[model samples]
Target: MLTAYLTHPDCERHQMGADHPECPERLAALRDHLLVKGLLDCMQEHEAPAASDEQLQRVHDRAWLLQLADQVPAEGYARLDADTLINPYTLRAARRAAGAAVRAVDLVLGGQAPNAFCAVRPPGHHAQRAQGAGFCFFNNAAVGVAHALAAHGLLRVALVDFDVHHGDGSEDIFAGDERVLLCSSYQQDLYPFRDSHPPAANVVLAPLAARSGGAAMREAVTQYWLPALARFAPELIVVSAGFDAHREDDMGNLGWSEADYRWLTEQVLAQAQASAGGRIVSCLEGGYALSALARSAAAHLRVLVEA
Candidate 1:
């Protein structure tokens, strides 16, 4: 009946370092803002459960999963890559963050919730099927999409990402998968620095220039994403909601604002209503500046809770 809000306290314990941009405080700031805005009042909140190994393996290689598990440290941190590190609680927190998305999918598809928002951290989207990178251990949105198709018997699903950086991991995992449509928008010349190779038809890339601002993003969505999404007629919609592109965040130079995030979410919701039975599972991805992250995330949630 209401939007399902899923999170776990353990999500905050997985830290890269005191100075890492993907710190635990990102979640805390957004959560506090949501509470203060009373957005949580309109939603049904639930603590996220750990995703089963089977569920995670559907979207990730079992060997890679085992490797990540083995890398968890007992005292300090283990480096997964230049941009990713795992502390003692990292694996558990990553599992819970990913599990939140899976549970959100379950709740929405089972008629328990009209839609859902996963507020967990250690944001996922950059973690590919075989390797974890970009401050991510598991691809949460991909895991959710896999579950919707494999476990829930859904054939058509869509994932929408609006992070400042390309979701190369999501693209890697879902490329050539006709059953799912992946529409992503990111600033050009950003992190992960993917090549300009031809993407599969299922994966639509809308790369904006630095400081292009929200106008370019909205135009890309209108010209590219809407057409593809309409044709797919998806049964569910999963969102990789990121806010680092905001003008104040300074993570990338897309030069967006809270209003842009609000508008983007509104478009996603409209598409969901068109063919997905209003089913949505939105997960937190990238947002750095504490004040901006809090404000932008709160803006996104206002649309979800109200819709």
Candidate 2:
């Protein structure tokens, strides 16, 4: 089966202020790059739907979500935090971004696709169960994991985050949840800083030093993530695929390149093939530098389709 590519126009509407790096151009760049590289032609495409309140509740507290919805601005921007802002369409866009992951999960698990990539934005790794940060309003990957567990009765789901910054929100939501194993490699001393020690047994937080390059990331995945993932033998695999670590991206100092993204996808594909019927639902989490994000995402999608 062909891989699925999911995105939405609403994602472009959830923009922060003009100077922010997580701008709408990120999505536009990815779309343009995939088209230019002929990557879009190899996959089935779908526009993301708005997530139901029920699905949002699986990963967010209902009251917190209600408060966020109530705070959305009609004409201007409302600041959720120092870095996160909500425009009139922000909440709807966040729901749609989260829904993209949920739908990708449904599609992959149902055998409609071998794997899927969500190209939506307002990146989700920094959004916690009850808090939003780092331009993230909803925990999209967490929402997808919850859907796989609740809807498909998945026993064990593995979440692998390769963002430059730690996936603190995902750690918060899945902490102590025995059914899920969370493995990640992030730049040390970065945003949402405290993930060196996860509060749960299933979390393997590998923080690499700045300028460590892709070799360090690859080593951590091979030595730590792979073993933990193999032991868990998950029924489904979820990826918080962030390309901010690229060398061209000033978002972080990991110095990764497009080849690194492709290599990482290959590793994840191996784990999925071994235990999960090659099922993977990757949600875009972070990537700011327009050109690098586009190239890295294209490399990742190429592997997701070819593998």
Candidate 3:
């Protein structure tokens, strides 16, 4: 079966501001690049369905979810934090972005697709179980992992994050859960900077210094992530794919290029093949520079399709 590509038009409508780096144009740029590179042809496309309340509750608190729903504005934006704001369409887009991950998991585990890539915006890795932060509302990758375990009845799962910033929100929800192993590599001193001492054994936090190049990241994956993941023997693997660490992106000092994204994806694919039945659900998280985000996301998607 081909890989499934899940997205929705509403994902672009959830905007924080006109000047925000995490704008809707990132998704547009990625889609255009994928089409131009002929990467879309090898995949099966599907529109993401709105996530059900029950599915969302598996990873997020119901009270927080309702609070977000109640806070949605009729015309303007509502501030959740200093960096996170919800516009009129923000609520719908957040649900769709999260729903894309859940649907990707379903497609991969239900045998409809060999693997899946979710290309939605309002990127979710920073959103905690009870609060939204870092331009994310619902933790998409966390929601997907929960869906695989709860709905699909899969016990062993893994989440791999390669964003420039620590996925503290994801770690917050999955810490101490032995059933899932979380492997992440991010810049050492960035937003929500607290992964230096990862709180759990299941979480392999590879905190790199500023300006750390792709080689350093590769070393972390080879030394830290590979060993832990191999022992887990997960039934499925979910990726919180973020491209903001690219050299061109000013979001962080990490100089990761498109090749790094491709190499890392291939490494994850190898692990998935060995222990997870080749199942993968990748969701978009962070990437600021438009050109770099487009190219990097394309590279990641290419590996998903070919592998």
| Per-model TM against the reference | 0.98, 0.98, 0.99
RMSD of each: 0.9, 0.8, 0.8
Query: In candidate 1, what are the lDDT values of residues 126-178, reduced to their tens digit?
Result: 99999988888899999999999998999999999999989999999999999
Report residue 98 deviation for candidate 2 (angstroms): 0.6
Tens digit of per-residue lDDT, candidate 3, span 1-307: 8999999999999988879898999999999998999989999999998889998898899998999999999988889988889999998998999899999998999999989999998888998889889999999999999999998999999999999999998999999999899998999878986848879888888898898799999998999999998999999999999999999999999999999999999999999999888999999999999999999999998888988
Q: Rank by lDDT, descending?
A: 3, 2, 1
Model 2 local distance difference test score: 0.92
lDDT of 2 by residue, 1-307 (tens): 8999999999998888888998999999999999998989999999999889999889899887988989998888998888888899899899999999999999999999999999998789888888888889899999999999999999999999999999999998998999999998899998877849868899998899999999998998899999999999999999999999999999899999999999989989999999999999999988889999999999999988898
How does candidate 3 fare on TM-score? 0.99
State the displacement of the C-alpha of residue 36, model 1, in Å, after optimal TM-score superposition.
Answer: 1.2
> Which regions in candidate 2 have their CA more than 4 angstroms from the true location?
none
